[model samples]
Target: MRPPSELTFRAVALGLLIGCLLCFTNLYFGLQTGWISMMSLQSSLLGYLISLLIPSVSPLTPQENVILQTTAVATGTMPLAAGFVGIIPALGLLDRAKDGMDPIHVLWWDGVWWCCAVAFFGVFLAAPLRKQVIIKEQLAFPSGTATAQLISVLHKIPPPAAARPGLRHRNGHTGSEDGYQAVRTVEAGGDIDEDAEDPGETDQKREEIVRAGWTTLGWSFAASGSMTLAAYFFPVIFAIPLLGDYLASKWLWTFSPSLSYVGQGIIMGFPTTVSMNLGMLVGWGVLSPLSKKAGWAPGDVGSMTDGARGWILWVALAVMCAESVVSLIPVVLELLRVLRANRDGHPEEDLETETEDRLVPMKWVLWGTGGSVVFGTIIVWYVFGSEGIKPWATVLGFGMGAVLSLLGVRALGETDLNPVSGLGKISQLVFAIVQPGNIVANIIAGGVAEAGAQQAGDLMQDLKTGHLLHASPRAQFHGQLIGSVLSIFVTTTAYSLYKRAYPIPGPNFPAPTAYVWLSLARLLRDGQLPAYSGTFMLAFGILGLSVSSLKTWAGLQGKWWAKWVPSGVAFAIGFLNTPAFSIARLMGGIVEFWWRKRTGGNRSANITLIVIASGFVLGEGIVSVVGLVLRTFGIGVASCWGCAEGVCPSC
Candidate 1:
């Protein structure tokens, strides 16, 4: 028997099941709003609770929890990768409708192929960089760090059988080994010192802690779920006008009463949310109105070429992309500076424990990465050739993706902000220069690069969690593979289902992310920026660069003010998202800061607050997905025309 490790079939299967259920919620919201709740925290809790519920099953081990989250996150985030919401739909928007059918429409299998082709390559890339990024640098991949902490809190009880050989630490024993030493020593036929207290007392104390953790989480979920269900029936509850009903409607200024938004804000935290609000104030309060009044953007609200939204996107991308490149420069140079030292060796490897034995080896990284390039090249040539995507684009896209992903993932690790807009625009520009005028190639190439960036960032986070928990990297890698396979099906089926029931780029689903991509593609295809937005773009780009430089300088000096500086990438997201989103997130941040202060430094209380936020996010997601399934067969509301695509008001 495989010694009760993280790679068990049970954990992977359960994770996939959870991920499948979770995918719908993300798909619904990722298009509806270009954000999805982070699935890691909720899935870890869900897996822990489920392990306890299932009779005769061994309690979920900490290592196994990493696997559970790995699969769940991988599967849950695939819709955006598969391009239902953005890339594919944007492609359709750019290409004229042929006989009233959208070219974005595709069979489920093809959708899977399209997504998986580039996604797996990134997964392979993450393995080699793990030692460098996660271990050596010890950067804070916040979600992964949080997930590891949560798993630790839940698995207070000892593993049922023998513990694995220790993943040796600086003290030659892990903190876990130290904590469980009293119990494990007795189990392993070693004589216990009489002074050592009763092992049963330790178990009892741990049981109480575990009990309290689960109870608090359960109540949070129950409370949030009840409220979410109630709000579902009362659609008015979802929005509370912040600027009065008329102004709220006109300016996209509303306080979303959703706890999910609050939870997201809590995850995002104060500095980031403040920056987002700053962007909203400048973009929505000032720039948008100014542009519209000047007739610079003369089309309807949704028009990409002549609307404020489209004009804002160019300026936002400029700020974000410029900052991403500029900020990434120092980090890239630092890596290059140390490249010789790393090539010689990391002495830390000599200290790594048995856990390293289970890791995805360096050889696999070389073989798998090479294979991915070949595989992706084939995919681009064969699958997308009709649309004008060349094999070279995919090859070069992977090269850019590999380079850019390091920056994106490092950003993700340091700040928990994945700079998707910057990643996409950078990739788009690269392809625009190389494969000029082929919109499909431009878009798909970016998609490929974005996939690498997304997957690389995601996998690095998972590896961080695994490294902390001493989980097998190979096991987590396998979980990622399983999740990727499952994602293809989940994303494809979701696209098919939603497309059948709703217009993708239509009213209810504005596909904010896709619109950005589509509009940018058109400009590149036409070889011109929006008429009057050049000045705005330049001004913001300078602002972003200046801020990045200041922050970087402050960071090196260890200035206290460095932490408070607004992130250029996150600030840019303010333009990408609605003002309402920033308002809600701001409210959530206030709630978190206020509650944390009230907790008076109680760790458990802080955790309980996190549980409440997670509950709200998960509850909303569950409710949204359930309603989507019901409406698929026309089971619920009558004539949801806002959801009825071009049949509705806005589109």
Candidate 2:
């Protein structure tokens, strides 16, 4: 096996290219069938196949192989542009489109929205941080970990000839005894692959495998499927109806929204989650000995307390305030560090010596970022801004986007926050006061509704994987464009079908953000602003910022409540969604958590559980997608064709 240090840029580059191809293939399938779960599975299989190919021409160390493999997995899973933006437009749901909508193909307006809104923003924001987050901080984005692990496992397989030197080590050593001794003698030595029986021989074998082709493809398939399966299935099974029913049985509130059975089940899942998370904050931060004795019964706090709503609001605000204070301190320190380093430390000047060998040049990153900005701008101008946008305005948007992105990196810890969630929180607060018609509220509300926390979390994980695999900031930035494009279409198509199948009751569900833009034909249309709502959104953003801050502070302070907050949010969203969804999700999470905790995070057991979860999720998702498609065709009558039918029909 070639040592990790010996793995060349060529191998890594090849891995990335193949990974992109594999991911695109999966996306194509997903679009056709409406099943996104294949994303991980396909990517991993491609990565493994790529590893085998690399071995044929060059020797590789296990680490090199793993690193290469990770790049592909991470890049492939990114949410790219798909048909999501087109759904409302295609379905004739937009305010302006009175003509009604089509079912099968995406419209021009949909593409414009994605190109302008998501693609433009995602690329604009993701690019600048490529240097700060991926290079400077060297965060271990986890997507690459899967690749790293798979490569490690495969590299351990014995080579036919043990004595033969395989891929050369980056440290300039070989498989022979003399080289082994020489390698060991060096201080602060390079990594040796524990999985490989003989690094050199393995490298040769890996190179041969790469040349052989089949093994490389096989590995890619396995990893991609495994990753996707785990991600897809686990979330659904965990959110079921059991817990929500119990919660509803106990609590009697006059004003509670008449949620469906599924929605109620989701709430049940959340109570534990929310209660636990909120309880953590109350117990550790509010009631702990540091402040004063606080415990509302270990892990079982009463749901109803004296003035509970008031207490919750006050605690929430306090946590938010504390978080802001804590976050500002580090931000201030980091700013100081930047100023000092730029001024007195003269770090940039000195960087020439170290940067020459230590890191990728900033010039390339800057050039690439600038180029993407230009390309993205032109796309927006052609698609949405057919009449043309002011040069200054476009430049300003790009510039401000960069700044916001940097702030996002520093504050949010990721640059891809959906305006939907932030706005959703604001809508909740506003609807409490205005009691506006569903028409006005639903536009923003619907937008945020489709954009969920899970998607946000997954995006961050993809970013993490990119970081771990040493992908160039430029590559990741560009890759995100690809993913965004794919996602837009996929989401839009699914959503359009949903609206058609089950027409929303209130004032026609307002077109999603993209539809608004597409209707206006770009350049910050007046109606798109929703001035009253925009002001509210600003307040909501502040609220979110506060919430994020408190969560951080509680954790740092070693407060008891930190653990339960996740559960709490889950509960809230679950309660809103469906009782069934909540219960299923909670059970799944509980089981997974228990297994992980008990086994000390054993790899095999975790993988096994994830696989099962993936199966369940995929199965459900497939049925849903098929149902949507069938509904689109006006085939409402239930038949004995697929699983959608009551009984399995024998072919």
Candidate 3:
């Protein structure tokens, strides 16, 4: 069985199930609070990484491969989970004709449709792109790196044995031992034409190739697992807030109202730095000194953990999500398309007269695709349209979802404007059309923001990994069906209950971008938000993005500096994500480069560093997972000790 088909099935199934639940919960919270709640499953990317490590019962089949791929693609984009709000508009199921829909209902069902749409897009849109962009361009999509690593292993071989047997001849021919001893007596060397192939050499070459395959599989699994593990754990050790620092920062200002060092780390500028340093002071300086004075513990793990953890965790999560989608998707689709084209031999194009040896069959794709459609239809019918949706509304939602996916793919391409993100935008637009009340508007907007912020980059990579493994894409899709079903039911129910009791306040300003549109819809109903300033900001931002004079100049010049400068500026901006984080990363990169150069490019050292970095990634991810779990239980953490009692501290 293929890697994704066999090993990834259960993992994909469970992950998707959990992810869907997280989205549902977030939707529920959005409705109750009149704002999006960051307490859903997706609130923590690190947590999901950990779950991937746990081995589960996999329904080993080619169909499972598609399920795994679909799950990864869906979760990787994460926006799809969060983007359910967009589906509301596409379906036209909201009661906008009479008045606005309720925020609570919108949040609960928006996610249901959003997930359905993403699953559809992952199959249909990605299928076509597999041939056009990925295979044709030979683009090195990083997401498929895992897949490539797996394939490279399968075609490898081991080294040949050293010894080979030779034919024995009569004594006169000097072939046997006795004849060889009588060197002088041997027959005159007649026809000493040595133009024969060496069996030993050929055997050795075959062995080497075979050995390569085993080595590749072993290494790939290890690397993949290590990466997942690192992402799971590192965040916890470094991402949580220091209790002492929290007390000092917030307590200095207000008693028993300390800030989470980790939370502050996520702030844009000085806040993160100040929060981290303060956390360190509490963890290392205050806590450590007190511990030493009290002679409680010898080591200072507390201080070490006290750095402004949450701030960096959130930012890193954002960056990781973005980088993952950007680097992984196109290559995956391209590779899969190439493999499929090569295997099946495009009949119309007359690409080939024969089919290539394939690990997976085309029938699996059809089955998986069919399965996705069925499951998706069921979800929409049962979940999203279960409300006042007319009987025909079910078909309408599904058809519209398909159409929207196509449009989204065209606009976003294999690289950007992910259908899932677009889904959130679309849902928000629909909510506006229906004019759900202000509460509904705020909830829907929050859902959109969360969806948009999800990592399109990761989804691309997950698909890439599946493609390279020769795993069944259809099976991966099926796994997605299982996961999504579980996730939607659990997360949604939990979040709805939380919202009924405690709702977060909406911002005075509108959501970042698409949410801005949602806010506009609300103005039509309540006229509560500022309109002119939001419009001005939008226009200015678009104008900034539109200026192509510089792009044209660079294109004309064809100068290296012109290209390098912009990239350098971008790097600088990225580095300023967080002072400590950027600095640490820079230092780590420098150390790695220097080590590689010193060792003459020793791979072992590189691998070691990768392992360590992976740990950091995992640690941060786990921390978020904890927060999401807590939120599901209606735990509004205000301080280290307890959560918000429906009071706004920031206010």
> Of the candidates shown, which would achieve the greatest TM-score relative to the real structure?
1
> Residue 346, candidate 3: how far off, in angstroms?
14
- How do the predictions measure up, each by TM-score? 0.84, 0.51, 0.46
What stretches of model 2 exceed 4 Å from their correct place? 1-113, 116-131, 134-337, 346-368, 371-395, 411-550, 554-561, 565-572, 622-625, 637-651
Residue-by-residue lDDT tens digits, candidate 1, 90-127: 76675554212235555566676787687688898888
lDDT against the true structure, per candidate, is 0.67, 0.34, 0.33
- Residues 1-651 of candidate 2 have per-residue lDDT tens digits of 222242457545654664454344333222221112213322333445545544355444443443444344334333222224222332234343321222223344544454334343434444435445444543332222333333333455322121112312111110000000001001111233444465456456655745544533334334434433332233222222233433322221111111111111221222233433343334323332221112322222112112222123223322223333344355446656766776785543221112233333467557655775576556545543422233333444445444433433443331112222222233323332332322322322222222222223233334444344333333433344444455444444444455565442111121122232132221122234321324433453465466655654554454656434442222122222212223334454455456556765444343343334433333333344454555467654432221211111111
Better of 2 and 3 by lDDT: 2
Sort by TM-score, best first. 1, 2, 3
For each candidate, how many residue pairs have backbone atoms clashing (under 3 Å)?
0, 104, 85
Q: Select the stronger candidate by TM-score from 1 and 2.
A: 1
Spell out the clash pairs found in candidate 1. Answer: none
Q: What TM-score does model 3 achieve against the real structure?
A: 0.46
Q: Which lDDT tens digits does candidate 3 get at residues 1-651?
A: 334324453546555654553344334322221122121111112223333244444212222333343453343333234343232322222236423553334465655454553344244334434434333443233223322332222222111111011211111000000000000101111221233223244445645543543354345334433442332233222222234445333221111111111111111112123322333333334433444444443332221112222112222222222322332244345456656987897643422211233223456546654565566546544553445332243333334444444433322332222323324334444544443453343333334333322322233333444454444444444444454455454544444443343332221111122222333344445644221223433442333233222422342344433322221111212211222223333343345445545655333333333334333322333333454455456555343232122222222
